[model samples]
Target: MAFQEETLNLQMKYFVLVKPSNSTPSCILSLSTIDNRDIYNNLCQTVHVYRSSPIHDSDSSFDIFHVLKEALSKALCYYYPLAGKLVESADDGKRRVHCNPNAENYGVPFLEATANCTLSSLHYLDNNDLEIAKYLVFDPQDKSYPLVFKVTKFLCGGFTIGMGVLHAVCDGFGASQFLKSIVELSRGRTEPSVIPVWERERLVGSITKQPFPKSPMNNVAFSPFLNETSSTVIKKYCFKVEGEMIRRLKMSLRKENENLGFTTFEALAGFVWRSRARALKLNNNGETMLSVLVGMRRNLKDFEPLPKGYYGNSCVDANLVLKVSELNERPLYEIVKLIKETKNVGSTSEYVKNSIDTWETNGKESLKMKSGGAVTVLTEWRHLGFLNENVEFGGNEVVNVVPAPCNLFASVDMSIFTSSNKFDDENDPSMKGGVNLFTSLPVDAMPRFKEEIESLRFLS
Candidate 1:
């Protein structure tokens, strides 16, 4: 595919402050767990596009902006913490949500804009054009707000919704729940089906002081705040892996190890891990790591499973490290085994409980995991329901979902987000019920990485 320059005449139309419709008490909401502080600097932004609704008359009487604004206001009543601002606590110097029910600081930042292009025009945008899409979303540098929203209307009547939520406020799953509620309200629903729960302190419980576990991968000394320089340029790539190909890969692995019952996620991640190590040309003895984000909501044994509406960070990072030569020479099944074992260690209910206990006792200063060296962070967002949310604007449901660029974070060697294919051709084997990998790599190594990924298709 050839890269084409596409211009989007995007202009900010208006800024709406979405406040809660019902009154609530004023107080500060403390982030109960230290895990919330881990992603204080990361911006989780998502963009969804919908085709123009056919219900509008020839006069274009359907006003989407007004409807969305009103619906969002109603949704804020239940998910009121989203309408609050992030402020530093004077005592602990930690950030917490200041939910002043008072009129001054109790509204979410919502921006409305228009563009000259249609949803089809966005087809020209590839992995490299993610910066353009990121600009369409609201990103606050000062960390003043927990949530910011942007809506862009196209000339062809299609529109795109861009959301930028601080990771400290909620993970992707939590954000989806909030968005679904907004959709329901937009469709004229009286109230949200699920009420949000905010018992973070009780769910996490008290911290217990104990010796931190010793793990080489988690003991890295790198920090994102440090100034680092390198000749490698950061670039992004996107690829579609067919469901059939994934099945074949898993089958081959299972044949080698009868006990191997890996999901598509494990199979694909193994391939990427090996391929990336080869492409980077790291020293044989150098350490290469793969970090996976494991959710703790369902894995908590001590506490009941988090409620459907618990909008907070409840994920723990698990890391698997191996010598570069071992990764390259090992069979694919072996790599899959390593990935599975790491997941098992992280997915255990006890592991999550211990993590919370440790973090609570030591606070943010005790976080040991650091991103640097040859580490690649993989986040699986396939089940987040980005496409199935039924988010309708002007009677049109969301047709496409595009994640923001991963190139902004330079400290990490690579960042990968995997999602189900949104645009697949009927005849294309690689596109049928497949997975799409949105990845970022150092520019100097991307060419070699592309070669490795392409080789996997034939090898499978």
Candidate 2:
């Protein structure tokens, strides 16, 4: 519906106590599969402790609707695709709207149409707890976004917010852009401090601009609402993984692969994806692919955080090749080696930016990928500054924050976000690594996956 309702004298709040900037701050965020209403409600509460607004001099200025709207707008700004400049179809006339010109104010009807298509799942909200209710305050309504955000009016004179943005939009670093922006906007700011740049053409336009990639955005091969109906039902579960555990895991893998040291993410992802592969027990010695999202922040050379600082999906996803059996049975270090080698070729932020063009010009179909095809994504967002426990709203607390699982067919998808439990070397372990997993296989998949993991236990 409306970004935020104005009736009932509604108001907005922030997790961070930022002053209303004259400009919109480019705050950002991302999510994992968190359909439970109670937890979602709790996340909506501002986790940051805010002092009395010196400017407001009174609480009258706080508008929940506006606050939530600010958050939604920034999130939207980050991944709206209106900003991406590649054309997937040719003059062959697939006759559809393409990404390159990110601005789509006229697509309001299209957004609403897509938004309305998701009415069926809305019932998931009817059963949420208060934590979930509060969480909905800033959630997004676009179903494509793994995160779900919605708005509901209350009889008492207010409304509820909902969001379910897919982690694909941007990772935690990107998400922070929106959060920062909303906080600034709520303070009554006008434009954003660091306006996000969606010039994908400049950053990563296709190598072949005349034609587009095979349109992953509009694949008829996959159904619009990718319900796991035909697949065996898989129950959802989550746990906080210690960063120390992750750090040690990386070190151990590195010791094994001294010549090709693996990053914490590669080691951990390789370990997990392989475990899941073993559980599948497929006969084919197929080539398994591990997808890692590469952030193009300042072209990877590590520029001072963009004067705009970590905004949107400045990422290029790449795959690592391994035998399915290797993924499941090989020493973690070997997998780490493979990951490092693949990444070593072109980690310059430059390649990440150029990939946009290469991908756009070459199209995904033209780029050959080795066949044995079991693709899994491996990434670590802990290093991205999401570890800061600066989220809160008024009296409410953000007990948790996670990105929903990306629904990929016949593919095992796993996303690991910075855990809320701190695990900084200096600070107490409040934030750890939280894993979000997804698959279209059977319900038996996960338990079996866990068993396969234990099969590779690294003995002391």
Candidate 3:
């Protein structure tokens, strides 16, 4: 199939306000302190692309919009909080959801659109043209609604389901649960497999309002917000690290410490961090940091596990700080060990509680990065289940899933995605295993970044 090199034109048809089929309670849902962080003050958008199957093409009377709208209504009946309004408290700046019973006031925005080109032309949304993203997702100017969706059909009969959800409402895991509810209903399921539990109070019950000291090592920093004033142009690039390469990297790391077994994330994130630091050519004496989200849902030494259906911002920040010289000079295995240790510490019950308390007390102002340090934020979406096989449209599973071009996370230094044969040609071995890495860097620095990562291909 010939792919189009230019951006495809999209026409927005109409928008519908979708509400829950069943009535829900009218109340205010309080957001956890973690959810009120400055970092999550924006929207998170993603697109799930589905190809035209024989069944969809053969049925002339089938309307994708109608099917989805019905499923959405069903989904909202269960996860009604998502269909509510995101409002702010007048007394304090904290955000909460006001679940108004009226449909006109609480409905989520749903849009219908059509694209001039086929999914193949856009390389299943793998193209570099960021312009294509504008039409794929609906971005509301105000935070009135907690969620917004757009369903764009391609000329070739393929369609993409795009969503924009307020990050403060839920983390990736929570969003995935809500998405699964819709998918299950769309597939004729009466209800979602896992019932959602609203337990924000459980996570934030213990509040110690005290200021915490800053990291003694000036080398460590939280990932910085985008530098709008910088003259350098940033470009996004996608690279694939084959499964064999990852195995080799992990094997090599294991040789350093036979007892220390490194998972794919530990080894890969460490490798990317080192590669980025080297590519940027930072001063050896300067500090470079790797920031990652550590999941806090598991059973800790002193804390019970969070309920299975409890989907909130149950994650803590974990940063691995190192001197540039040490990072570049140390063996890859040692760096992987450091990554593993950072995660271990960050996942502990005491550490998680302290981090939450510190964030709650310090407020958003204290969430700034140091003035003179390079930071890379790594988010693992491969295991997020955004592209689960069960999430199908018209009996066909989605072929590709991509974050909206406007996503703030996309502006970060690096993001990792699941590798799937479905994303590309099934015959292609490279897409079947390993992970896909999306990287953003200064235009001039990308080539060096690519070079640094490319060396991993021959690690074995």
Top TM-score hit: 3
- Scored by lDDT, the top model is 3
- Model 1 C-alpha lDDT per residue in residues 1-460, reported as the tens digit of each score: 1122356677785566788888866878877674355544466777777777667635476766777788888988888888888777678766678888785656888888877777677762334336677666776545577788888788878777888777777777888888888988888889877778887775454657663454544333232222266556555567666667676777788888998878788888888877776666666766778878887767355556877778777777677888777888888899999898999888887777777676666665664444444677787787877777465554676766777663233344545555553456434566566787777666666677778766656654
For candidate 3, give the lDDT of residue 352. 85
Q: Which structure is stronger by TM-score: 1 or 2?
A: 1
**Count of residue pairs whose backbone atoms collide, per candidate:** 0, 98, 0
Assess each prediction's global lDDT (C-alpha) against the native: 0.70, 0.40, 0.76
Q: By the TM-score metric, which is better: model 2 or model 3?
A: 3
Q: Residue 449 of model 3: what lDDT?
A: 77
Candidate 2 lDDT over 53-73, as tens digits, reads 333334556555456555545
- Model 1 global lDDT (CA atoms, 0 to 1): 0.70
lDDT of 1 at 364: 56
Residue 325 of model 2 has an lDDT of 55
Per-model TM-score on C-alpha atoms: 0.89, 0.58, 0.91
Return whichever of 2 and 3 wins on lDDT.
3
